[model samples]
Target chain A: MEKYKRNERIGAIIKVLGDNPSKVITYNYFSELFSAAKSSISEDILVVKKTIETLKMGRIETIAGAAGGVRYIPIMDDMERKDFINSLCNKLRDKNRIISGGYIYYTDIIYSPELVDKIGKIIAGKYIFKEIDYVVTMETKGIPIALMTARYLNRPLIIVRRDSKVTDGAIVSINYMSGTSSKISTMSLSKRSISNGSKVIIVDDFMKGGGTALGIIDLLKEFDTKVEGITVLIASKTPEDKLVKDYDPLMVLQHLDAQKEIVDIVPYEHKDYV
Target chain B: MEKYKRNERIGAIIKVLGDNPSKVITYNYFSELFSAAKSSISEDILVVKKTIETLKMGRIETIAGAAGGVRYIPIMDDMERKDFINSLCNKLRDKNRIISGGYIYYTDIIYSPELVDKIGKIIAGKYIFKEIDYVVTMETKGIPIALMTARYLNRPLIIVRRDSKVTDGAIVSINYMSGTSSKISTMSLSKRSISNGSKVIIVDDFMKGGGTALGIIDLLKEFDTKVEGITVLIASKTPEDKLVKDYDPLMVLQHLDAQKEIVDIVPYEHKDYV
Candidate 1:
């Protein structure tokens, strides 16, 4: 709070919400306490709401009727979450994504949050249903989706390091071939992470050949926990099938031939939420 | 909109906000339009507010009088625009962080949006005063900060790829000696990225030695563009002064001796925004 104004109306609003079991509060009372214009109070609430909710500190509820006001609820549940992962699937399935040879190009989807949120939500919803203990994802592209899902679920996200560090202490490593390279790569997590029998949801941005999916699956097994569910933002349509099965995909890439500049993207069957 | 009923409501809220000159709206009208309960409608509003506003669609406003409601304003001045980057710099300077040897652990900060928002805002603010045409950052840890800053500023974030792929066509590479290792390694990005004279900001998660920062600086200079700003989440207090003088660190590490078991952290002085 050094750079931010401590006595600002927004800070006061957040302070008024200090550790309350109830997430809801009346705007009028908050407005009165701040002694600011209702419009200014409203703006402060808007900023605070965005900051807290995005930071995963419960959610802000704005009631409009006679009893209407604002509420800050510090609750985390498995239901009513879906957006990022689903959109990610839709963008990944875009036929316009031309993959030359065996590799698929996710340039459009990675750069689009609409897609990322869609896929993040779908994967998050599925895991939230299973009482997930933690969210585990690899580095780079997967980090964004993992961060999004963890935020939605209100859980701590732990990254599986590609290279073990001395700071991480003794680590447990898992190696599997990548979907695209067919070359063996490794991922590791701290030995003290997630207790035995804990449920874990594996999420990634995209899974073309399922090599990364299988690698995560391997890591989960090594931890002696439940895989619970595996979610990928996008999967490629392979005539020869993929490396792994029994997982969910947000979207499917039909054709990706970058050479001909043709990419066919199709929507997934996750329209139930609509 | 295929993932949740709330998404439909959120989408409707955005659609209602289409091209509206006013930045504020009444909760009653929005709720009535959806034919949803005022409370439920408020919940929907919060979701849409965070998603859209975070993505830089506009700001949310509230009126306090009996006739007041929420409003969406699409105005962000240079200072206000960089809130994302500026926040990024602030949160990364947490003194609570513990570092062993030269490496600092910011995994917890990266996973938190509140922290990310702060870090994102600070970095964005630095370039807000500059003539930045683009935002650039290295892969892995830096992508999230860069992306958040880019989103808030409504600029595209170009990532430097550590590993080259077939789809990248031609690539330009730069070498840097990592903090963990004194050996030099090459990092590459697509050749057609930043145009000549384009102003850029270089961002990263941690700056143990500034090798990667220097590497990206070299790469941007290769494009004949100027590096408008260099911002990092954490800078190591390695006793040896940094080689790159044209950089700003949100936090500087004072102690990082594994054998000594001590660490200190502090924030950098920044412009006061009231």
Candidate 2:
């Protein structure tokens, strides 16, 4: 518990603000929650705010009114969103990067901030109409994108890990086939990570067969929550029926020939961003 | 050209610094490059430096000596790294986000400042060993990651679009089977985008079939450059014949069961980060 005390506190404050975004909390509320003084609570709030602002994740709007406390809203607009995505794309195209079997080695790009930002905005823009509450993606690289999107939308990004970790409490698991892997894989989400009636967006970098995507769709149904939409960075006409056929692709992988040495790619139009 | 004249100027300055980390550039050089005044050049550097610093992308080390100018270096430690990722992760986990199909809708996250910081740090961390002159990724989601990583690494995040846009000049393309689409796809990098002998890293969200990964690798090889490494968030067990075999995974999809009544799931180990 101590390992995550700071994180837990931030989560709690976020939750309180998230629950009633319009309703601000006084220092006294956080003070009582952590058994700390009012000043300490204010300091913690500063940390939270600093973290939010530094990450471009969200904003902690403060009101000095007698009844005002704090409100957190995650939002971003077009120019900033495009700039962030442009940054990530640049990293993935570096010349020094290696490639072997036919993938552009972009493990570094997945962890990069620019990619996370663009992914966040793309997903947020897609679901802006849904009045969404939680953002979800399968773990690892999707985590950053999910987190960034949640920050932009002023919501939360929940990660469905492939397996339960020691840190996650009371894990809920599911079995789903990965169309790309052509194998059944386990996916897990924390019991407390999501709530009922939550609107979610599913995102990933690439989608081939989409068994994992479909599996994720099925998982949300288990939570009694709604899936607002499905989005992928790249999509193609793979041999298998795509699990994410219903979703839109930001970019399309039209054709590629590893043996003959030919590959065709198409970028998503800018119309969506503008 | 006009659309990105200013951006390209800033990008050029970043590239210059990236190529020569130990050297400084006089305001006169930038002024001449942009056909602006010395004061304007200084102002632009200030803006660029501030932007990079705010994102923690990198630092613009200034020298006051008569011959002194500005230089950049890619540097960050574990705590900064951890804090960056945690903030992004927290933002994406907002409860108000809605979920469906197991994906976290995060188009906005890609554009958010929060993600820019986290992703910048993540990619920079991976290239710590490499004398990276640039960060690269394909278009769309990968752009932001490339940009931010470039900022942190004090380099330019060069982009390789699927196809050439009107603004781009001549391009060299490669063909490889896309892991996601399983078809011949075109992969291209602008002739002006990157320089030879640059160190680079590759990144993406998921490694399913890794066809796109391979296509990118092929494109890089066309330039006869060195790829520092590849990193990904999720490495789905798509089959061992992937284009990228030696790489790091933030998380792995360890288990799945498509036929089960209620699926059972588990997440990958946190050892990668630890």
- Fraction of true contacts retained by every candidate, in order, equals 0.07, 0.02
lDDT, candidate 2, A1-274, per-residue tens:
1222443345455434543322357877776666666665566566667655543444577767667667665444455665655554455445343233554444445444445445656666666546777767775445555655665565656667777644345667899887766677899876766787788788776677888788888888878888777777666656447766677666566655555544455555555432
- Model 2, residue A98: what's the lDDT? 25
- Give per-residue CA lDDT, model 1, range A64-173, as digits (tens): 88887776544332233334334444544454444445455564355443334334544555554357777888876676677656645556566777777665545799
| lDDT of residue B17 for candidate 1 | 49
Looking at model 1 chain B, which ten-residue stretch has the lowest summed lDDT?
A: B15-24
Minimum summed lDDT over a 10-residue window in model 2 chain A is located at A1-10
Highest-scoring model, DockQ: 1
Q: What would the DockQ be for model 1?
A: 0.13
**CA error at residue B91 for candidate 1, angstroms:** 11
